[model samples]
Target: MNNNIKRTLTTTILAAAFTVQAGENNFDQAYNSVSEADLRSHVKTLASDEFEGRQPTTIGEEKTLDYLTRQFTALGYQPGNNGSFLQPVELVRIEADPNVTLQIGDDSFEYKQNMVIGTSREQESVSLKDSELVFVGYGVNAPEYGWNDYAGVDVKGKTAVILVNDPGFANPDSGKFQGKTMTYYGRWTYKYEEASRQGAAGALIIHETAPASYGWSVVANSWSGPQYHLVTANGNKDRVAVEGWLSVEAAQTVFQKAGLDFEKLKEQAKNGPTAKAMSVKASVTVKSSLKRSKSNNFIATLPGSKAPDEHIIYTGHWDHLGKDPSKKGDNIYNGAHDNATGTASLISMAKAFASLKQRPARSVSFLIVTAEEQGLLGSKYYAEHPVYPLNKTVANLNLDAMNILGRTKDVAVVGFGKSELETYLTKAAKRQGRIITQEDRPEAGYYYRSDHFSFAKKGVPALYAEGGAESADEESAKYRKKMKVILNGCYHQVCDEYRDSWDFGGIIEDTQMFFEVGYDLANSDDWPKWNKTSEFQRPE
Candidate 1:
């Protein structure tokens, strides 16, 4: 071969080799088109101190959604839902009675200091209203597992007390529920849903930071503000009558009075008998006022050339922990990593898709939801009122909290293998010299915690991937320690602010990999399926 021809052919071969082997490092050229810096900048701004922490149903909501809509418009993505970038998400805002009081006989406890309660009910005012209280051990009614906490009790118009997670969660060996891998039972939301379904006037979930995997202050900080929820024109079962969390000390005091061993009895419920209602034999009366309001969900879409009706969605909640005026230090819970990063990634991915010459075989929707901290409310609303039919929707790619802990050798994925989405992830991770690790604690129910669950419940496969918990530049021990620290501190706290010291390398890599996964799905003709045992599997 001539020298010039040989040199050109060799360069082409080398480029092809990089494409097939290590495209993760080719991030510059691979995403040569992607501007992660710009994405991060917008995310930083949205999650900045000025946004008031991006709380739903507030001015913060207005600024965050407006910016997102503008960005999507600039990127040439069409408004995803009905030509409107902003989809109104009506919610009933209910704050606990500031001077709220809880009582058992002569024992009375103060609000915030002791217990807090609120509801999704639309009534201008709602009171526990002299409702009799019943102790419902674990208060779970899992007919699928032949278990019923309300088996013989009549809590028709009373209050029920329940434990936090599922039975097998505390002790890893019991295996009744998804042991330690938080099943839906582990979620406090499920407890209230079951209570409301049973027509209970009120329901309280006992809180233990260890079991709940979060703190009670999480309750106080999260609820002590304007809450947002989906407002149904017809508000019956759509509303959860009375729902809130209780502190451990409070639960201990209440359980002590009934002469029942709360912790011990909880251990017993693991395998011996199905969970049952304890019947504290008391009544609760909570008088409170409510206000109704509406919020918006920002959506953008890239239509498919072949399967215009089929879709692959990317979603992130635009809301944050928000600032608490009373809290000391940094008042802003600027959720930079918690989700601003995720939402920003959605925008960047949309831009990349918009820049593509060949459109995907299936459509792509970028959704920025509201009120995620208020328990995935916006996504739930979308699931109920979808712009595109569920069956035609292929998959959901969810970004919640991405790791800012420098770059790592691996990227972890939650709910990694419940659906065919994992295959797409595997392909992307391979390029990054990383592999998808299943959530270390499945019992924590990380899968059900985010908006992705909204789609999973409707049979659309979903992937919620996170940047690695481990850091490559740091020692393995420190990497693990960093993981521990993030869980306890900064997560959902006012301290979760943006830092210039953060390593965007991992985030950039993760976003690109996420795009590649969705891109493959969007361009391919494959209809991913659920493994037979997956609870989310579609029925034949």
Candidate 2:
């Protein structure tokens, strides 16, 4: 090779790299088009008191669905569900009468005071009278981990008293049940499902503030309302007659009455592989009225220019705790940060994609689902009856309550290391001069608490990215402290309303990074795959 020829080739390669970098700046223009003013406007409107907290099966649903449909149409995207933007989801709203009670041996626990109970069964009335109670350490039966909390005890027709989170959470050993990082077994949803599969008549989870990741008020506020669940063809026949949570005080009382040391039992449960289930002297009566209603899951799509059959989903739940008129001053649980931010981002991102000079090769869909505050019902229905086949759906990027704390030096990938989508996320984050990491509070099982889990359960790879702890400014220490305060204090509370204190700089940056990740994936032919050992990789 001649020196002149080699120099010419090197110069050409450098020139192209510069050109690509310059082209990236053009893409940034599209990304930066997601203005903070737009995000704030959308959030303020959706989270306003007028929406009645955005609850499904109420006036809130009408306002929310209408707003999303209008925004999607304005963005020039087509309806995702066939030719209609609305995907009708039939749901049963069940509210347990305040007359519920639980009796553990000689101790009596009153409803909403010591404990709360509800049923998944679609019935006008449901009850579990004189149902025996059994202490199931964690109520998990994982064959992969070779651990079974319900091994020796049979809970059929009995009430299974379970612990929140999992044994690995309390124990420090990484090799034991994935250590502190909560898995499917640690999720409350998984606990109830296991109880039902075991033919248990009822399931009650003991709530400790730290392990449960929220206070008793949160538990009460979240579970006490009209719980919404998709109306299954089987009528939730396999479900337990009752499922609820017992306050720590209530649990202590039950343990004392049963002649068991509460702290000692907790220690045994934490020391996994040795904990055992035993029968307790207790019973429960659960009664609830079930009313059927329908909610619309707003879905819109930017069809692929090339591979129209393939899909990339973007999900954000639009539901929040409705107006609590019982409160004295502020009654509405305006979930501004809880989800209005994410929902607004959905509109902003959709608009950005529509502004692209050319559509990506793979289709991208925006799903603003309902009843997430109640449960992931809207997404669950979509997963069961998808507009696009699960096998063909490439990946899901879920936005839920994005940080309004300003841009940070890192992005938190909730349930990180579970899929190849993180590879894309890491690259996109790096391009924005940020790092990628995992959720700081993995034990909370935040991964299973959102809409993305619906898609992941159906074997599609999902990504949930959020702002990380490393604040980009000098207020780093203050930012981290404030982060804890918000999650502990305002999260899921009436205080979660939109505040002028929020610095939308970070939200906009994270939004752009999310858009880029989806943009890259939609343009590529590659199908993201779950990591080999991912618990959700198994196809349904």
Worst 10 residues of 2 by lDDT: 10-19
Best by TM-score: 2
RMSD of each: 6.6, 4.9
Local distance difference test values of all predictions, in order: 0.74, 0.83
Residue-wise C-alpha lDDT for candidate 2, range 1-540, written one tens digit per residue: 763455346445443543464374456667879998999999999999999899888898899888888888888999988899999999988888877667776677887777888889887666777777788888889998889887777788888888998888898574778788888888888999999999998899999888888888888788886889989888897899889899988888777766778889888877764333444555665667788999889899999989989999999999998877667898888899879999989899888888877777789999889888777989998998998988899999999999877678989889987887876676667667888888898988889899999998888999998999888877754765675676567877888888766778878888888898888788777777787678878464
Q: What are the runs in model 1 whose C-alpha is more than 4 Å off?
A: 1-30, 129-131, 233-241, 274-287, 326-330, 473-488
Q: Choose the strongest candidate by lDDT.
A: 2
The clash tally of candidate 1 reads 14
lDDT of 1: 0.74
**RMSD of model 2, in Å?**
4.9
